[model samples]
Structure formats: structure tokens, C-alpha cells
Target: MKTIEIKGSFRKELGKKNSKLIRKEGYVPCVIYDKENNLHFQVHENSFQKLVYTPEAHLVKLLIDDQEINAILQDMQFHPVTDKIIHADFMKTYDHMPIVISIPVAITGDSVGVKAGGKLIVKRRHLKVKGLAEHLPENLTVDISELKINHSIKVGDLAYDNIELLDPKVTTVVSIASSRVALKTEGEEVAEEETTEEETAEDKDKEKKS
Candidate 1:
């Protein structure tokens, strides 16, 4: 996992008015919870976006009053109307402690099924994984080069060291289906019916001429 360093200032006042003032100053209100010490501290808001938008799960290096802590973004609140971030919460990470996080799924290689006129469908975009924060991956990659039509990649087929996927073992991650072929087959059936009707009308006209 990657780590990002963000500087945060301690907040003195609490409640809606003070939080509103913080946002008006272009800062966000945040809190950090340390399970080891059972401590929670209020922090400023601007130091959050880097952790929020990254594709990779990150361990944040939080610097407060010259003290540094390793933590993860736990939860956040957004304005219902404006969608602006309102508040955020962080959980401290400890070595050897297990944590659950969602990791992105990356599709790799050109699939044979796609080349053979099968449409590739991604069933799951991310996997929920449980493991030590340090050992957890930013994203899991699945190779689909050998996939054939009607074949699927399941969660049970994936193997990662020191990480356990929380998704059901039988759950499909990706699969190849014959969507376009089915549509073409339906079209061909309609054309054949039209052709038969035209032939029947022509035969009747020839009989009448005789």
C-alpha cells in the first residue's frame, strides 16, 4: 500500500458554528481516532483530498503539532445539496492488526473470447479484502487472455499472499457472453420469415397465371 503525508492543525472549537467557520475558510473538519490510546482529536479539513481520490488504498501519515501518526480514512460526510465534503473521520493503524478495505480490480491482457466475437462483461469492479494494512494490495489484477466464450473468472480462482477476499468464492469477477451473436440470430430469423412470405406470394401469382 502507498502512504501520503498530510499536515493537519488541531481544532479548538466544536459544533456546527465552528465547523461552518472552518469550511468558510476553505478548510474541512476532521477527526482521528486511535484505538491503542483510545484517543480522538479534531483536525482541519483541507488535508483530505489526496487520500480520497486515489485509486490505491493508502496509509496516511498525519502530522499534527509535530507528532506523526499512521491512519486510514474511516468515513466522511458530504453536503446533501452541494456535495461538498463536510466532515471526515480517520482510524489509526497498528502493526499486526487486521483491517478490511476495498481494492480495485484491474483487468489485464487481451481476452481470446473478445476476439472470438464474445462480449466481455466485468461483473465486479472491486473486491473487499481483509488483511494487515501493510500487506494489502492497492489493486488486484486478473488476466483474461485465455478466457473463452461462456467462461468466467471467479473469486475462488484468485490467489494473493497475505490477503483474503471477502467476496463469495463463487462470485464472478468477469465473464464472456454472446450478446451480439444472440441479436444477430434474432435478426436472421426475422429475415428468413420475410423471405418465406415473399416466395409463397410469388408461387400463388405464377399458379394464377397458369
Candidate 2:
């Protein structure tokens, strides 16, 4: 994956009051954690724009105080009213260990289905995958050059070197359906939506508890 450098300073205190103070100063309170310690820090809110706003995954070269760390963005909190990022959580990583993250999916080429008057619908924009940090790419690129009407590119159809897809094999990532010839696909999609929706709800619940 691509790497970007971010500079921050160690947070001297930790509390709701201190956090508010940090935000008032235009910095976002942040933390990096693992099984051991949680290191508190703050980085300029603007500094996170590229990392948080983009769809692609990126690794961070964190410069906090005088120490350097390599990490991946693990989670973030957004202001409910403004929809702005207020805080972030990162996880320190090593070269040899595996990390699970959601990577953006990039579809290339015009679908044959589209060319044949069928509408192509993207059901999933990203895929969750597990692999060593070095093995992960910036994004998972899928070529839809040969996708015909009513055809789909599911999680099971994808293959990558050194990467294990974490999503269910039957999950449709992208598909060319809903055309006159494929109207029946809509019924099948409803079932798939229910499955995906349940997974999303579970993830939200876990995030809230965390």
C-alpha cells in the first residue's frame, strides 16, 4: 500500500476537557494502541484530510514527538452534526504480522453488459482483506472487461497474491443486472442486501462498544 507521512505531538493530558481544549486549538486528539499501551497524541485536523477523506487505504509514517512509528488507521470518530472527523485511532504494525483492513475497489474497463444496454451496478465499493502490510496494495483493482449482461463479479471470483479476502464468497462485489433480460436479478439482490445489511449492523454495534 501507499505510505504517507504525518506529523503530530504527544498529548500531555487525557480527558474530555483536554480533548475539547485540543480541538479548540484546531488539532484532533488521536491515539495509537495495540495489546500493550495506548499512546495519546494530537495532529492538525487538516493533516488528516488526505488520509480520512480518501477512499483508498494508506499506511502512515507517524512522527510523534521524537519517536517514529509505522501504523495503519484503525478507526475514527466524526462529529454527528458537522460530519467532520473529531478523533482517530491507529494501530502500530510490524512488517511480519498480518493486518486486516478494508481496501477500496477500483473497477477498470467498460463492462460488456453496459455496452449491450444493461445497467451495471456496483453493490460494494470496497472489500475487507487480510494480509501482511507489505502485501496489501493501495486498492484492489478488478477488471470488468468481460462482464456480460446478468453477470457479476463476486468475492469468490477474486484472486490476489498474498492476500485473503475476508468477505463471504457469495457476496456480490459488482454486477451487471437489472436490464430487460435480467429483471429477475432484482429478487436475488434483495436477499443479498439483507445479508450485507446485517453484517453492517453488526460492525456498527462492535464499533460502538469499542
Candidate 3:
């Protein structure tokens, strides 16, 4: 995977008040969890633009107090209203150990189904995979050049050396949906919309609790 550098300073105090103060200063409180100890630090919000806004996975080079740490972003919290990032959590990584992360899926060729008047639908923009940090890729490529109408590319069809796909083998990553199939799935789309609303409510509750 690609690497990005971030500079931060060790946080002397850790609490809600201290964290609020840090945010007021345009910094985000962050933690790096390790097997031995957890490191607390604060980084400028601007420093996360490339790391947080991008779809591709990246190994982070965290510079804290003149020390370097290799880690991966584990979780992030954002403000409920403005959607500004409030806090971030990272997990320390080792060269020999395995890491699990979602890698962006890059669609490479034109689909044959589209040329046949079928609609191309992406079911997954990313896929969760587990592998050593050195073996993980920046992005996973999916070729749909030969996909025909009503056909799909499932997780089971993909293969990568030294990387294990974590999603279910039956899960479809992309499909060429014919108009007839699209009409048949209208009710399912409505059900999905309801589920999304429920998830949004749950996220708002989590933000309030935090």
C-alpha cells in the first residue's frame, strides 16, 4: 500500500475539556493503540485531508514527538452538524503481522453488458481484505470487459496473492442489471432506503453519547 506522512505532538493532558480545547485550536485528538501501550497525540485537522478524504487505503507514518510510528487508521468520529472530523483512532502495525482494511475497488475496462444496453451497477466500492502490510495493495482492480447483461462479479471470483478477501464469497461486487431486473428490485430498493435511515439515526445517537 501507499504511505502518507503525518506530524503530531504528544498530548500532555487527555480529557473531554482538553480535547475540546485542542479542537478549538484546529487540531484533532487522536490515539494510537498498541499491544504494549496507547499513545495520545493531537494533529492539525488539515493534515488529515489526504488520508481521510481519499478512497484508497494508505499506511500512515505518524511522527509524534520526534518518534516515528507505522499505523493504520482504525476509526474516525465526526461532528454531527458540520461533519468535521472530531477524533481519530489508529492501530499500530508491524511488518510481520497481518492487517485488515478495506481497499478501494478500481473498475478498469468497459463492460460488454453496457454496450448491449444493460446498466452497470457497482455493488461495492471497496472490499475488506486481510494480509500483511507489505502485501496489501493500494487498490483492487476489477475488470468487467467481458461481463454480459445480468452477470455479476462476486467476491469468490477475485484472487490476490497473499491477500484474503473478508467479504462473503457470494456477495456481488458489481453487476450489469438489465431493465427487467431493475424493475423487479424496486421494492428491495425501498427496503434498503428504510434501513439506511435507521442506520443514520443510530449514528446520530452515537455522536451524542460521545
Candidate 4:
């Protein structure tokens, strides 16, 4: 996973008044939690844009005082009306310890069904996975080359090295479904349409030319 460094200062006092003061100074109140203890700190609000306002998962390198810690953003709180970040939480991570985090799903390849006029639909953009930090990938890649109309790629069908998917097996990640312009179908039982001799020859020719 990608990493981002944030510089913060340990909070001297802990209370609503102090937290409000921190926010007024353009800083966000934050905490880092681990097995042993919880450390309170404050990070400048500007330092959170790339980390909080992104779709990618990241390992946060926190620099507080003379201490440096590796952690992940666990939770965040936003102001009710302003929608500004009010508080943030981080969970300490270890290279050898297993942790669960959500990873973005990246789609690769054009679906055969889509080329055949079916509509491609993405159901889940991210998948929950568990593995060591070193084993986690920036994103989970799902190939849709052979996906057929009316068929879906579910959580159970995906596999990644050193990581386990935490979503339900039946949850659909992506699917090729029939659309107004899709080829005519006889029934739902036929997930994929049989290719005609002419179409097969055309495909072979296209492959040869490529």
C-alpha cells in the first residue's frame, strides 16, 4: 500500500475547550490507538486532504514530537453543518501483524459481453480484506475478459495472494447485464450467447491482425 507522512504535535490538554481551540487554529484533533495505549495529538487540517479525500487506502506515517509511528486511518468525525473534519482516529499497525482494511477494486479488460452489446455494471467499488500490511496491495484487480451477459463476478470468485476477502461470497462485484441494445436472448438459462461461425472467424482474424 502507498504511504503518506503527516507531522503533528502531542496535545498538552484534553477537553472540549482545548479541542475547540485546536480546531480554531486550523488543526484537527486526532488520536492513535494501539494495544498498549492511546496517544492524543493534533495535525494541521491541510495535511489530511490527500489521505481522507481519496479512494485509495494508505499507510500513514505519523511524526509526533520525536516519535514516529506507522498506522492506518480508522475513523473520522465531521462537523454537522460545516462538514469539516473534527476528529480523526488512527490504528497502529505492524509489518508482521494481520489487519483488516478495505481496498479499492480495479477493473481490468473489456468484458466480452460488453463488446457483444451488454451493459457492464459495477456493484461494489471496494472489498474488505484481511492480511499483513506488507501483503496488502494498493488495489484488488478483477479481470472481466470472459464475463457473459447475465453473469456476475462475485466475491467468492476473486482470489488474491496473501489476503482473504471478508465480504459475503454471494456479493456481486461486477456484472454484465442485458440492456436495450443488447443482443436478443431466448431465456435466462443461456448466460452466454453461442458465437456463430462468421463471428468466430472475425474474432480469429482480429486476433491475428493484432
Residue ranges of candidate 4 with Cα displaced over 4 Å? 183-210
- Candidate 2 per-residue lDDT, tens place, 21-90, comes to 9898999999999778889999999999889888789999899989999999989999999887789999
How well is each residue in 56-83 modelled by candidate 4, as lDDT tens digits? 7888999999999999998899999999
Poorest lDDT segment (10 consecutive residues) of candidate 3: 179-188
The CA lDDT of each predicted structure is 0.82, 0.90, 0.94, 0.92
**Cα lDDT for residue 109, model 2?**
95
Over 4 Å off, model 3: 180-210
Q: TM-score for model 3?
A: 0.83
Model 1: residues >4 Å from true position, as ranges? 36-46, 181-210
lDDT of 1 by residue, 21-41 (tens): 878887778888775453334
Ranking by lDDT: 3, 4, 2, 1
**Which has the higher TM-score value, candidate number 1 or candidate number 3?**
3
Error of 2 at 168 (Å): 0.9
User: Of the candidates shown, which would achieve the greatest lDDT relative to the real structure?
Assistant: 3
N/CA/C clash count, model 4:
0
As a TM-score, model 2 comes out at 0.83
Candidate 3 pairs with clashing backbones: none
